[model samples]
Target: MSINLEQIDELRKRANVSYEDAKNALEQNEGNLIKSLIYLEKQNKIKPDEKPCNDNTFFKNVKSLIKKGNETKLIIKKNDNVVLNICVTLAVIIAISAAPIVIVGLILAIITNHKIRIVKKNNEDSQVNKIFDKVSVVVNKVTTKINEELKTE
Candidate 1:
């Protein structure tokens, strides 16, 4: 059986294989383009389009964030002793629901020589750690500025 130059060239270009391999494939498949392509694929001479792996990074980050939140603690102290200890999530809820109450408590704590501390129980390096560290730095700066202002007043 004879194979045409065009068929061989087409198969060679489509399969990204050498001319000889393409000719052999076309001849073996009786000059059928689709069958020759399939034959090349089956022989591992051509690679099929690959699908991407499922990325679950977002879900992993969310899970880690939740875990970090659970492990975070807000401790209110007076005279080097813990007066109140609560998880970060609960503190946030209280702070949000009763903003003025929280502010008053903080001001009173400052006036009475009390200390407020945020403690992270988890020590693992993660995306959540980066976010929490940045937030902590900002909060610390703001708290220090407020304390300075209050002291001067």
Candidate 2:
């Protein structure tokens, strides 16, 4: 059956899609009446199968990739400047609490002992950078995929 602008206008009104959108889809299907319907159906931006493409092949791949990221508890984190300050403060608190007896504490306080400082520093941050780095990677990967898809569509 032949489909024309008038018929498309009717369908577009029924579909609640813009005239431009209907026109484009109609043109893209190259005048094939059934193909246009199928295209709209596949997009799920239409009735009959209005449920969006939730578990589509693309999302399934993304979910699998995320699962891989979760296989190890390693996660990158957002760069929050305040977190750095907190890490430094906690390290100092723990160091003071673990201070040896009053005598040794006085000695440690007097000396510029670098070893204890290093240990406290590691404990305070607790690999915050490593986790954030992983998160950033995941975000970039997902963003790249989304951008690529948008470009193609």
Candidate 3:
């Protein structure tokens, strides 16, 4: 079925575009909502895609994004078994009562353990991972450097 008039109207409101523009985009794109949105966005007509910004749909999308973000945060905040164990072992090896080592170890443990969790979560979340993948490389680099420095010292 073609995109309905109500939906087009809603999109117009959400996107903050003129009635004629929204109608033309949807009609020109032939029921392809994403294409219509892309057209509008490319033409500098809207805010370049949002959560649709209406009722349950927008809120649900927001919640899903929040959930995805939270899951990612959890993954970045946990440590894998090997990393955690190594952290604990290092703390012990570093000093008798090395508070700094222990704390750092704990932090690393929390960070690396999150990897698998985030990976698993990405499989379930569509756009969530796309957003994160963009920044993953930089984050990985910083974390790797931190790990290397900690190991050396």
Candidate 4:
């Protein structure tokens, strides 16, 4: 099939390829404009309908979520009355610093009929709550184990 000069020029302009490359693509694809474009794309001489990856909204949202998680409050209550309220980061620090105390406190809370609730201060979404729920489950398992061991002894 004979490829015209106009077809080569148009392909060069659309695909951002050199004159020789565009002409070669047209020749290889049997003078079909669509197939020539596909050939150029396959050869990495042109990008085919690509969306820009410059959007920073995803990163911004992740940063905001991290900030929100840091600001989230953990409220410890005894008999429906608030005993302690601290941010999640601080709670994590305290838990790390006083692991034994934290475990003993949880056990005591269980015995004294206390409730622990994690609350997100600014965000209405449940992302932070979901994380806290997982943490609470782990804590509950540890406390239950400790309770069992105490009973056995």
Over 4 Å off, model 2:
1-3, 47-153
Residue pairs in candidate 1 whose N, alpha carbon or C atoms collide under 3 angstroms: none
Residues 117-141 of candidate 3 have per-residue lDDT tens digits of: 2343444544545655545555677
- Backbone clash pairs for candidate 3 read 75-114, 77-110, 78-110, 78-113, 78-114, 79-112, 79-113, 80-113
Candidate RMSDs in Å, in order, are 10.2, 22.7, 16.9, 8.7
Estimate the overall C-alpha local distance difference test score of candidate 1. Answer: 0.78
CA lDDT of every candidate = 0.78, 0.52, 0.60, 0.78
The order by descending TM-score is 1, 4, 3, 2
Off by over 4 Å in 1: 1-60, 122-153
By TM-score, the best candidate is 1
Better of 2 and 3 by TM-score: 3
Please give, for residues 1-153, the per-residue lDDT of candidate 4 as tens digits.
888889988997799888999999998989999998998888899945454654578877876866875888877786678998887778877899999999898667655556667777664544655654566667678878989999999
TM-score of each: 0.41, 0.26, 0.28, 0.39
Give candidate 3's error at residue 64 in angstroms. Answer: 34
- Please write out the lDDT profile of model 2 over residues 89-130, one tens digit for every residue: 344345577755634643433232111121122233335555
Query: What is the overall TM-score of model 1 with all chains considered together?
Result: 0.41
* Winner of 3 and 4 under TM-score: 4
